[model samples]
Target chain A: MAIRSSLWLEYQIEANWTSPVIFILYNTLKPVGGSLLLLAMYYVVTGGFLGGEGLYFLYIGNAFYMLVAQTLFSVGWIIHDDREHYQTMKYLYISPLSYFTYLMGRSAMRFLLSLLPLSVLIGLGILLKIPYRIEILLLIGTFFLGWIFVISAGLLLSGVNMLTARHGNSIGQAFSGIFYLFSGVVFPIHVLPGWASTAALGLPSTYWFSLVRRSVLGKEVDSIMSGFTTGDVAVRLIIISVLFFVISYLTFRLADYLARKKGIIDMSTTY
Target chain B: MNVMLNLRALKGRAYPRMIGAVREPSWMFWDTFLPILSMAAYIYVYRSLDAPKEFEGFVVLGGVMTTYWMNVLWGMASQLYWEKETANLQLYLAAPMSKMSILAGMALGGMFSTSVRCISIILIGIVIFKVEFVVTSVGLLLGIFGVTLVALYGMGMVFASLFLMWGREAWHLNMIMEEPIYFLSGYSFPVKALGSLSAFATVIPFTLGLDAMRQLTFPSMAAQWGLVSPHLELGILLVMSITLLYVARLSLDRMERMGRSKGTLTMRWQ
Candidate 1:
């Protein structure tokens, strides 16, 4: 347990030091720029500011979506880097420490790191005079649930990448793009086409965004869960998170078994 | 003999990149199809804001132009880092061909691949969103896009040289470029509306090109041309291209000399 925790801390320190300028810039400016871009689009289209409610939706939606996208991509890339770039996957696989525990620790570290940028974005929002109704307890609760749901999906993706070794990066990119499109990150899901909105229904992000927007902006929670209360939404998220965790764990174990059978556990090249 | 060798090197280098990019169907889908999702998101933003229906066309055009920038940043700029990681950098450096020829080949191949994807995206956006373009001058629009590619890829050459010296830090540099450029370049909105930043944005090649193209295609809906005319934008792009290419060559020479002294070219994970 101690070793696992230490490894997680070491990973965080190393990542921070690796091009610290770029790391800081990316975590700060990327989300800021992203939110501004969305707001800019809204401004141009409407010929006016997005008012307080609209600005709040765009602000928290973009910030939270960026966090989810980065966390998910990092989880997949961590596994890909261990196997392909660093060539440390085999040793880690053979180690006594639990891989699941290691992954959870990494996810926890990433979630914590993500908060710095999230706070920066919120500060920008406040400066811009976007209205907010912060329910601290609900915000914290939604964040935890959102992280679990996102991390579980990420683990499943990492496992899928293990099975399809050559396309791991593409797989990650595809998911990020698809999620950004369908998950109501920049706009409400209702604005999407019928088919796309239907697809969004299955994603935990839809519910997560609802909870977040409702908590932060005091917007009404709607969509497939329109009939459900806030508590009902929370319960649904818990159920979805547990379901994703089980499926991801099983998928990861299957991928490990397949990799051993194929004798490609230590393959360094992408293909 | 030297001329023949350079020609052969250019062809040799370019064909492989073109083939490699499409060798896997999945790669093609990710580069081409997946990016449309981003376009879709922007479309939704327009819808949410109740922007003029024509703004959908702006978002689509911006999305299409972004493919070229992606090619420049990832396909060209980061090519050397990828080669170094794969141990091909050493082989290329030892070869007799000029490094410019290799980079040119990569730029050509990247343009070809990304252009195909860009066209697909534009077509999809038109069909799905029913975006109507009022192209007043097709030739002028094409000219803007052509010159923009030249300037953008020339910048890519400079970036490639820098990345050659940067080692693993190149990846972060590439990441840092993505969202900032989209915001600054007015990929989904008019740079004129960016207020004071408009002056800074006009200097960027893609911003100039995109602004000009939008002017020619949707004159009524387009922002004020910071350069006054598309022809001037084309001339600016040409000058920028030549200057950037020269800088790329100079930097390549400097980077090679420094890499040799520091023994960093062959060093991995630095």
Candidate 2:
């Protein structure tokens, strides 16, 4: 019930500002613009429009990575959105509802919001003649796992933001920017420097993208984890995602305790 | 038309942005660090493709201009919307000063911090990527850059008024503009690569500015990669600078009237 209510609330907050047609236009154009940006880069670098396997690798990797970028950013920023913008964080906390569930609900909305753009990118990929051999069960399983991992990380960020000042608002984008570099979103991670590639392995997002590409492309077309089988990648993704979930729960608990003790739960950064 | 009073208004508005740039040391860290990450990623992409060394230089220059583009969007364009949300818009509206002066002040203040970040990114690109440049005319380069800032911030001033006239759509519009502008402006590559689309991109002041800079900085690639002659780009930027500032003034006056009549000058959270 809490999840449903928060989801509705989020929809209203997101949609009420503009007409439906304009809203859809805004949502679609932004992501398509982002993908086209990558396509333009690939076109310039490779001197091929979209026929090469490299373009497909980058196109698909970038598309799926949007899920992480948007969902994680939306969830991570909910603290400031509620406290500073809406000025309702304190009231929600005092209610008899688990804030964790509420956050998950918000994450759910963001995940849904990202889908239109994700689908548009995939369609664009298909039009570009990128061969997609999807294994449905594999794609669904990998997606849910990836979603879990992103939400967990977002919750952790939200907890940290609760403790920090408003100046830390860009932390979400900064983290996403880090992932964009390390996780082989637009390029292969092995192409990264030795130290950077080593750092890439430490992030679950690296494997998540690997598996997602595997499920859609029917093979590890281009990945740092090419040596590892699908089973190995899945296991690694599961373990790290579960690890992130546990750590996030503990961090939120601690942050909640500290925020309450510090009496900054309703702290408004904007005067 | 008291010039002295408006100049003070400009100074008053610019003072906080300039101070805030350095006051929060962490902002500098993220500002430089994130762009460097992006710059490094593009450099690696070019390296992976075995593209020419000049391509990396293009990315470096693009990275530098990207700082200014972002500052224009977030620091100048949407600044009024942020102020409105923070309850500062009412005070500004009530003041007896030119809105153009306030925006001009923001543009100047934003330049101070963006300049710091741009220099940082350029220096890091030199050390980390071993990027090189060939500058035949320092005067021409500075001239293009100056005109570009004028035109870019002039457009930003127009956006400032439009953003305040709307409500929450301003945030969405800003969010939607970022990657699109980067793509359209060819922030990480030569705009000519976009082919005929590059003509449409000229409406954005930085596209030509970046292309002109790349041509000057990498003269060898200029013939092959130059979108158009640098002199032509310079002339366009100069024209754009005058046209956009005039439009900015007209838009600010019109939007201020609309906002006041619509009772949206102080509306929050809508």
Candidate 3:
């Protein structure tokens, strides 16, 4: 019930200000713009659109990344949005609802909202006749795992935001930017240097994106994770996701305690 | 007395932004670090395609100019809306001196902070990426850079007034300005890559400014990438700067009148 209520509230906050048509258009424009930027880069370098393989690889990777980026930012920014912008964090804390669940509700809504862009991208891929050898089962599994990884990271960010006085919003951008680089979102992980690639291996996002690309592109495209079997990826994703969940849960608990003790949880530093 | 008040208001509003970088290590760190990550990602993309070494320089220069574009859009353009939401707009309007001074102060401070980020990116590109630049004429480079900033910030001032009038729509508008502008402005690639599309793109000061800088810096690569000659682009930027600033003053006067009559100037949480 709390989650449902929170979802409705979040929807109102995000969409109520604009006409439904305009809101959808705004959502559509941002992701489409982002993809076009990548496409422009690809075209400039290749000198033409001679090869669809590289384009498809980048397109699929970038589309799925929106889920991680949006969920991470939405959940992370909620702390600042409520405390600083809306001034409702204290009221929310005193409510009967579980704050963690409220955040998860928000995270889930963002992931759902992100699906619009994902669909638009996939639809474009089909329209352009980019071959997609999709395995429905693997695609679903990859999405579930990606959501777990994003939420955990977002939870960790929320915990950190609880302690900051100003610019808690930037925390989301910092995390998303790091993931864009390390997660092989727009390129292969092997493209990174030895140490950086090694660091990428530690992140669940690496395996998550690899599986997402594989689920759509199949094993035809070569990648660092091309050698791993579907089962191997599933096992690694589960392990890393669980590790992140435990860490983020514990961090949020500690942050919650510290924030209450310090009396700064509802502090606003807009200046 | 009025001139002194405007000058004092400008300094007063500018103080925090200039000092914020020094006072907050984390903000400075993220501002410098996050842009580099994206720049590095693009650098790798160009490398993977086996593009020439000069392409790395193109991406680096794009990253530098991007800092200014972001500051103009987020800092100057959307700032009035932010101030309104925070209940600070009423105070600003209620205070003596012109509101344009507040925006001028914001532009000045944002330029300083953005310059720090730009210089850092350039140095990192040189030391780490080993990107090289050719400067045939320092005067030409400086001329374009100055005019581009003036034009860009002048547009930002106009947007600030419009944003105050638009309220909630301003946030969405700002988001639209970001990645789309990056593509249209050829932030990570040559504007000429867009072909006939480059003509429409020239309305954005960054588009011509970035192309002009690239031609000056990478003369050999410029033939393939240059949309227009450097002098023509600079001439366009000069005209744009003058026109935009004049339009900005007119818009501010209109916005103040509309806000006063509509009773929306002090409105919050709309």
TM-scores, each model vs. reference: 0.91, 0.94, 0.96
In terms of TM-score, which candidate is stronger, 1 or 3?
3
Candidate 2 off by > 4 Å: A163-171, A252-271
Clashes of each: 0, 0, 0
Q: What is the lDDT of residue A194 in candidate 3?
A: 84
Q: What DockQ does each candidate score versus the true complex, computed on alpha carbons?
A: 0.49, 0.49, 0.57
lDDT of 1 by residue, B214-238 (tens): 8887787654433357788788888
Clashing pairs in 2: none
Candidate 3: share of reference interface contacts reproduced: 0.50
Would you list the C-alpha lDDT of every candidate in the order shown? 0.76, 0.82, 0.83
Highest-DockQ candidate: 3
- Report clash pairs, candidate 1: none
- Residue B250 in candidate 1, Cα distance off native in Å: 1.1
Off by over 4 Å in 3: A50-52, A165-171, A220-222
lDDT of 3 by residue, B10-109 (tens): 9988888778666666666556777688788888777766778998899999999888887887788888888887788889889988888999998898
Query: Which candidate has the highest TM-score of all?
Result: 3
Candidate 1 chain B weakest lDDT stretch, 10 residues = B221-230
Q: After TM-score superposition, what is the CA distance of residue A217 in candidate 1 from its true location, in Å?
A: 2.1
